[model samples]
Target: MTPELVRELIARGEALTLEFKGEERRQLSENDLVETVVCMANRPTQEMGYVLIGVEDDGRVTGARPRDAGGIDPLRIQALIANRTRPSLSCRVWVVELEGKPVLVIEVPRSCKDLCVRVRV
Candidate 1:
């Protein structure tokens, strides 16, 4: 997504379809991330859900450092979901620059199945 879109989401604040994760301060808990993905996927909406990393709950942008951004691997997230979630789910993860800061965006589509069970992290 573009920086403008990111800003818009931030302005809108967290909701059922959007979550902000401030990874610049601390690493995201694997269990929390897995559970959130499951919950968002199972939500009753046609639109996709978003997990915006490097953003705080209060709409602050801490930003993922360049080194840390390089380490934010989407494949690792996919593997975790594949192993832990029942019926399996796919997500698109990418890094977007916002005012010279890197933000990791994980986009999860609504599940076709009735539920997205989170078996484990």
Candidate 2:
């Protein structure tokens, strides 16, 4: 997504289709990441949900930590979410530079199955 869209989402605040995770102060655990993705995917509507990392609940952009040598790996994130979530959720992952910091964005589509049963992480 574009940087402007990310900003708009943050301005709109959290909702059923949007969540913000502040990974600036404390690193977000892997389990929390997976669970958030699962929750967004399970939303009742078929609309796309977004998880914006590096953004605080109050809309502060402190930025996400680099997972690799120089940046976060989108492919790695996609694989992790797919592997951890039940029904194997597939998502689009990317990074946007805002206020001189990197924000990680995970776009989760609604689950096709009845529910994400027995999701373990």
Which candidate number maximizes lDDT? 2
- For candidate 1, the TM-score is 0.80
Flag regions of model 1 displaced more than 4 Å: 65-70
Residue 55 lDDT (model 2): 97
Q: With candidate 2 superimposed using the best TM-score fit, by how many Å does residue 10's alpha carbon deviate from the native?
A: 0.9
C-alpha-based local distance difference test score of model 1: 0.78
For each candidate, C-alpha RMSD in Å?
2.6, 1.5
Total clashing pairs in model 2: 0
lDDT of each: 0.78, 0.88
lDDT string, candidate 2, 3-32, tens digits: 999999999999999999998689888788
Query: Tens digits of per-residue lDDT for model 1 on 11-116?
Result: 9999989988887667777776778788888888787799887898898888754333556676777777667887777788777788777787788888885565
